[model samples]
Target: MTCARIPTKYGDFQLCYYTNTLDKKEHLAFYMGDVSEADDVLVRIHSECFTGDVLGSRRCDCGEQLDRSLQMIANQGAGVLVYLRQEGRGIGLLQKLRAYNLQDQGHDTVDANLLLGHGADERSYSLAARILEDIGVKSVLLMTNNPLKISALEAEGIKVNKRVPLEAPVNSDNESYLLTKVQRMDHLLQFAPPSKPIKQRAL
Candidate 1:
C-alpha cells in the first residue's frame, strides 16, 4: 500500500492505495490517527457511487453517508474509511446507468440490477479485510447499514466489535431506493416517513 496525506475539510487523513491480484482496480483507504495494532477501530467499507458521491445526485444517499462517516471519524479522532471501487455494487458504470433508466421507469434498485443480469449487490469485503490487516487493525466498530459487510468481513477473519448504523435522511427522489434496501436487501436503516408518499412502484 502506498499512502499520502489527504487534507480534507473534516480533517487530515492518510489516503492509502492498494492493488490486489484478484482485480486490476485500485482501492483506497482514507484514515486518521494511529490505528496500527489498534482494537475496535472505527471503520467504514464504502462502495463507489459515481452518481451519488461525485455528482451529488439525490437518487441515493451515498454522498451524505460518506460525508457523515468522515465527520464522525474526525470527531472521534481516529478511524478508517475504505473506498471500494465497486461501482453500482460491482456492475460498473455503463450497466449501472442502464439500471438507473430501469429505475426511472419504476423498477426498484434491486430489480433493475437483476433485470440487467447482475445481482442486487455484487460487492465483496475480502479486499477491505486485507486492507485492515495491512493497517494492523485488531478489530472494528463498523459503520455501515449493510449486514453483508459485517458478515463478509467477519468471514474473512476481521473481528467486528459492533455495527454502527449509518443512516441518511430519505427524500422523495431516493425514498423507494432506500426502502428497497431496508425491505428487500435486509439493510439496517431507520427513517421517518417521507414528507409525502412517493408514487414509485412497489418493491
Candidate 2:
C-alpha cells in the first residue's frame, strides 16, 4: 500500500493505493478524517466508470454518484470511499463500450451485457471489505443504491450499520438506464425521480 495526500474540491483526503491478491487490478481508498476504529463511518464502494466519472457523460449517473458520495463523506467529517477497478460493471472498457453500442441499438444495460456474454455486474467487494479492515473501520454507514453491495460486504465480514442512499439527479439520457437498474437489476432507487426526497434504507 502507498499513501498520499490528495487535494480535491471537496477537501484534503488521504488516498491509499493498493495491489491485492484477489485480482490484478489496483484499487484505491480516498478517505477524510480518522476512520480508524470508527463505526458508522460513511463509505462508498464505487466501481470505476470511465465515461461517467471522468468524461462527465450523462449516459449514466456514475459521475454524479461519485461526486455526491464524496461530498457526503466530506460533510460527515469521517468516511471512506473505495474505488474498485470494475469498469462498466466489471466487463472491462472495451466490452463495456461494445455493450454501449448495443444499448444505443435499443438494448438496455442488462441485455447489452448479456449480449456480450457478461453478468449484469461482475464486480466484487471482498477487496472493499479488506480495504475497510485495513483502514480500521469497525462498521459503516454504506452510501449506495445497490442492496447487493451491502449483502456482499456483509458476506465478506464488513459490518454495515445501515445503508445511506447515494442517488444522483435523473436526466433524460440516463433515465432509461436508471429505470433499467430498478426494473431489471433490482437497485433501490425509489427516489430516482427529481421530485422525491432522498430516502434512507436500513441494513
* lDDT score for residue 104 of model 2: 97
Q: Which one is best on TM-score? A: 1
**Which lDDT values do the candidates have, in the order given?**
0.91, 0.90
Q: Estimate each model's TM-score.
A: 0.93, 0.93
The sequence of per-residue lDDT tens digits that candidate 2 reaches over residues 1-203 is 78999999989999999998878998999999999998899999999999999999999999999999999988998899999999999999999999999999999999999999999889889999999999999999999999999999999999999999987887778877987888787899864443342243211
RMSD of each: 3.3, 4.5
- Model 1 pairs whose backbones collide: none
Model 1 weakest lDDT span, ten residues long: 194-203
Instruction: Quote the lDDT for 83 in model 1.
Output: 95
Q: Tell me the tens digit of each residue's lDDT in model 1 across 102-133.
A: 99998999999999999988989899999999
